[model samples]
Target: MKICAIRAFTPLTAALGLTLLLLSFGPASSSTGWLLAQDEAPMRGDKKVLTIDDYAKWRSVGQTSISPDGRWVTYAYSRREVDDSLFIKEIDGGDPAVVVRGSNPEFSKDSRWVAYYINPPEQEDGGGRGMREAGTMPTDLHA
Candidate 1:
């Protein structure tokens, strides 16, 4: 009876060990799914093949902040290697104008004001300057 029990337990233990071994290596095999998808075409009809120049011309928007009333939005827009600019737009529909040469835009709690930090350009003396040091920081807040 003892020998019969040992034979049953041995097969069960081996199967459990094999399952754990396969699970341990699961992530490495599953990561290849992304590689398989890379060769597939995009799901848009009007999409064209992207090139390096297209990336350079790409305008990226970042870190959008909406007003409390939901009527306005402030965000940063930038081109490749170019200066980032802050912009505010009405949600109802209006042209977005550049508020300042800055990023990380924020809106006031009252939804009446927008603010952003102006990053100083590199100085010729290889030093950095703050907004005050650069003189006349342009802010969207009036008052």
Candidate 2:
């Protein structure tokens, strides 16, 4: 009688353990699905796709520094495949001027002057070789 009782209990215990294991590792519940559905909904209706021309005309602005007296702002701007230009403008309002052709513009402590680095133009070997073969190298450092 005791053996019969033990045998019947064993199969029940095995089924309960398997069910618990599956529940722990199975896919997430319906609440997770509802949250994901909310996130997938669009926030706006009037968005337009961007085109290549829009990208071509875009100017990327880089590091900016303000003058010590708060009178001038200096920044670097560049377009794709173009040399970077350092621009300086008056805070009150005026056309920005190209101070130099370089990157990483900095303002002096007294805001009297701006400084930056300019890479020297590449040199050709005069052998009518392509860029990969000519190996033009930067020759000078400018500020």
Candidate 3:
């Protein structure tokens, strides 16, 4: 009787184990089917992976400021191997003003204008290089 019972359960146990193994390695949808909608599945074909070339062309926004009247927004846009710019845009509508090589923008007290620093063009003279290591000061320092 014991041998017969063991023989009867051997095939059933094997089938159950096989089923569990297949479920463990099945598609991700099988596990997350309840959380995701049927129409909201990932569009894998439309996506493109980012590469190193994409990073080089990327632009980023820096510090931002709002006008006193809350009518305008100013922010710095910077990119690699290109001059940075300050963008001043009207809050409600219209095109934004672009200031090349500008940074640290501040709106006027009356909100009539914006003030910012225009960075000097980069020179190949290696200005400010080795200031700490060589203990040399730049002669053209501005207050």
Clashes of each: 0, 0, 0
Q: TM per model? A: 0.50, 0.47, 0.53
Off by over 4 Å in 3: 1-46, 124-143
| Per-candidate local distance difference test | 0.49, 0.45, 0.51
By TM-score, the best candidate is 3
Put down candidate 2 lDDT per residue, 31-91, tens digits, no spaces: 1211111122234566434455444534545556555555666566655545566666665
* Best prediction by lDDT: 3
The true-versus-predicted C-alpha distance at residue 142 of model 3, in Å, is 34
lDDT of 1: 0.49
Better structure of 2 and 3 per lDDT:
3
- Model 3 lDDT per residue over 1-143, tens place: 01111244564446433432332332322332212112233446765454555545455555565555656666676667777877676655555677777776766666666667777656568563221111111111222
| Structure candidate 3, residue pairs in collision | none
